[model samples]
Target: MEVHTVSETPPDRPPQSGLVRALKVPRNAVIGIGFGIALAVVAYLARVLELLGPFAGTREYPVLGPEGWFLVLAFVLATSTALLVASVLTVVEIVRLARTVDE
Candidate 1:
């Protein structure tokens, strides 16, 4: 006579619901925003340190100088980067979710 042995591995979990997966979009956006901000800060610092080059544009106003322009550019760059990254991640997540559901 032969005896059967039991396995200890846990069963695989069911795929997450679409809504649950979708909820991660906001988290992805936040991650993108953080990355963008970090990138902008680094770029700004490099420009300020003359690593890029000396500021040549004439200052139109005393308060808003080249530094201020850099800040403005950084803001735009960060915002755009955030949007792009968020959208891309969202699409990728959706596709993955769809594949999993189909399977």
Candidate 2:
């Protein structure tokens, strides 16, 4: 029979906290992806209702511009930006935690 004793010393690099660990979710981006989805729906309905039809000539209200294409793009970009920023922050936080542990 062999008896092995593990060392009590702390790890060189500690594991990150649960909050920091949660940021690893790809789809869990902190951005407004859901909000973007809703905006897309609204833009679709606006186009269908021809709400922007009147602006076709005057090119008024960016929302009504180019058949509301701009609005769709804006909403999607906005959501992506938000999510991107959130994900970045999460990554930074995790990195910071890792740095602390390494120290």
Candidate 3:
């Protein structure tokens, strides 16, 4: 009589390290990015409405006007900068997570 043996491996599972275990891809990054965008929008709106920072008024500073042109410029610059920084940070985090996961 001949007998055969079976060899099998267990199923994979997610790590459990408290808060670190709860970390997820894309979703967390998207949330962070969305928060950054919202922050930028609020900042821009507050600046336009003269509700942000100390220097809040309707007076010309250098070249742009206070109501339209100045508000638009401020919004553009603030939003762009915020989005750019958020995006870079998100990318970096994703890369780091990927590296760790690979290891």
Structural similarity to truth (TM-score) of each candidate:
0.69, 0.40, 0.39
lDDT of 1 by residue, 1-103 (tens): 9999887997788776656557577788898999899889988898878787886875574678778888898999899988888888888888987899899
Q: After superposition, how far is residue 20 of candidate 1 from its true place, in Å?
A: 7.1
Output the lDDT of residue 10, model 1: 70
Model 1 lDDT at residue 78: 93
Ranking by lDDT: 1, 2, 3
Best candidate (score: lDDT): 1
Task: Encode model 2's per-residue lDDT on 18-84: one tens digit a residue.
Answer: 5545655444453446555666667666665767674355545554656466666757766776576
Provide the global lDDT of candidate 3 against the true structure.
Answer: 0.62
Per-residue CA lDDT of candidate 3, range 28-95, in tens? Answer: 55665666667666766776676856663546566665556656765576567656765676566668
Task: Evaluate model 2: give its TM-score.
Answer: 0.40
lDDT of 2: 0.63
lDDT of 1: 0.83
